[model samples]
Target: MIVTADGSAREPNFNRHITTPNMRKKSINMMYQWFVVSLVYYGLAMNSANLGTDPYISFAASAIVGIPATLFSAVILKYLGRRLSLSGTMLLAGITCLVTALPWPANLNWVIVTLATIGMFASSGTYGICFLYSGELYLTVVRNIGLGSNSTWARASAILAPYVALLGMYRREYPLLIFGVLAISASIAGLFLPETQDQELPETLEDGENFGKKQRFWTLLPQKPSIDNNSAVEQ
Candidate 1:
């Protein structure tokens, strides 16, 4: 066992981490977010062939969108902060998925493909943000445990993603509808999490518990320095 400088044993207390109300809520929220994001991300890719476009083109479009989506995620995380950026992308993805599942005329197959492409774009961005956001949410003591648990949820969803795509054989809309509902639900769950932008990482369990307790729901953006205050200081 590792001992701290104070000569106390540094064994991680998994029970305390899981049983604490705040940490527990954060874990549940992140689990759902990870599951839904992974499900939608992989589901969209696998369901590409059913988008009524050339399978090759549809697949390529999904793959290529990841570049811009990741860049977009970086911009949003920097400006909008973690909570809003994550939920916003997931919400956008959910809406597009729901629209894509609508029954449109065959002539409007292009519309379906377009919406699906947009969903893919948003899901990819959420996927990138989740990796960073999860780390910030957990205390350093159990950070590895938290991330590993979230990754397990993601992998479980990925395993089921192919089967979700297979639902397309019966009705192409079924898979998309499922993805849409879950993404939206996850977005709502994500909103309960506190914004982590410009905040110090939680280094202890107590720190994690109290991190975002003071934040209101509407506080989604990072706090910027007041230009007037800066000018006054300079003067």
Candidate 2:
């Protein structure tokens, strides 16, 4: 509909015209991104002592795992779609977890440790990008609210991560089991979500909503205003 006084149609796109249902559709998958990203911190808390000997070595060990994985994820995000990148990271991280669980000797511990380090780094980068991905998903009007809520939930997980890790450590096998389950679940969620890689920004809520709802120009454009030739002739 046109604004009667001004006569300008709404800006062309889904972001502005998007519906509540559009927003709700992707909520579950995005939440997984938020929650699972924070799990690495918990993993660190539980697994640090498993590294043995000097505490600095353990700390260094964690950092080592995180750095490369972080870099790999950050660089690949733009190149690959969000779903593929995240799914790959989680799947590999799961493998890394299983590898780390292997009964290797102290001398060969470096190999398993390296895998975990890579997983941490990859997980860190994947988690960090959620802020960017979610921010890009919504329009500017509610952009802050949308992404902020997601980030809040993700970061909020930090408060409970350590406690869970400590509690799980009390039972020895619990933390590993928990991470294993989360890793698998997140990978599945990543696989199911729609790909939004390199798509143009939706200027309004409706534009974002209709992002997948494509149509021809004639379908959206209104009829042009007609000239009153009689009035012109009388003048």
Candidate 3:
């Protein structure tokens, strides 16, 4: 039984979760974000060897950088809120990926490696945040279904990432270029999603539909009490 907005209980209907306007919009946005995050994360890892560095070193660096990035993501998610944290990391990844694709002097291979590593770091952070953010965005009644669908999209993108990397055969920058564009686009899409930090998770269809309705596009942090307002109230 699901408790609705009006305090009535009813059997959960799976179809309503998908058909509702707000729920549908949020799901689409999350699916796109998941797809891009998976593609870039896997794509960069797969193409690390082609970034003008030793394959073993590049691969190992990619694996190791994720640790600090995940920690940084946790810190930012606690303060910056889900929408900003995800979008900021994705935007950073996108910009770095694009910069890494730029033609540079052959002697500057280390520069390429550095930029690629940063992109990987940001992508890694975004990947970790998506798991928590998606859970919060979904209604409790269909949370599992929502997460499964997003995961399916992510896996599908992962499968296609190798093909994206293969484009590097024609031009080494092609893979990063694609990944960058997608990440930037996903970042923009993420802004439209409601910030879920410190907010109650929706349990019913009505709750899902109404969730975050009051927030504007620029609202990135949780609301806090104003000192002036509190002082005035005390007076």
Candidate No. with top lDDT: 3
Q: Residues 1-235, candidate 3, lDDT per residue (tens digit)?
A: 9899999999987775345898899999999999999999999999987777788888888889999999999999989989999999999999999999999999998888888889999999999999999989998898999999999999999999999999987899999999999999999999999887766778888899999898898777766533677779999
Q: What TM-score, over all chains together, does every model reach?
A: 0.87, 0.72, 0.87
lDDT of 2 by residue, 1-235 (tens): 4454577675455555435675666665777767776775456545656544354665686676556656777777767656667777776666666556556677775675565566566567667567666776666787877787777777777766776567544653455556656777777666655555645667776776765344222222222234679978898
State the displacement of the C-alpha of residue 149, model 1, in Å, after optimal TM-score superposition: 0.5
In model 3, the Cα lDDT at residue 122 comes to 98
Lowest lDDT 10-mer window, candidate 2?
215-224
Q: Give the TM-score of candidate 2.
A: 0.72
Ranking by TM-score: 3, 1, 2
Clashing pairs in 3: none
> lDDT of all the models against the reference?
0.90, 0.63, 0.91
lDDT of 1 by residue, 1-235 (tens): 7788898998776666334788889898998899999999999999998767778877888889999999999998988889999999999999999998888898987787778889999999999999999988888889899999999999999999999999998998899999999999988888899887777668877788888888788777766533577779899
Among all windows of ten consecutive residues in candidate 3, which has the lowest summed lDDT? Answer: 222-231
Considering every candidate listed, which one attains the maximal TM-score?
3
Give the range where candidate 1 is weakest over 10 consecutive residues by summed lDDT.
11-20
Off by over 4 Å in 2: 1-19, 51-54, 65-67, 102-108, 212-235
Error of 3 at 152 (Å): 0.3
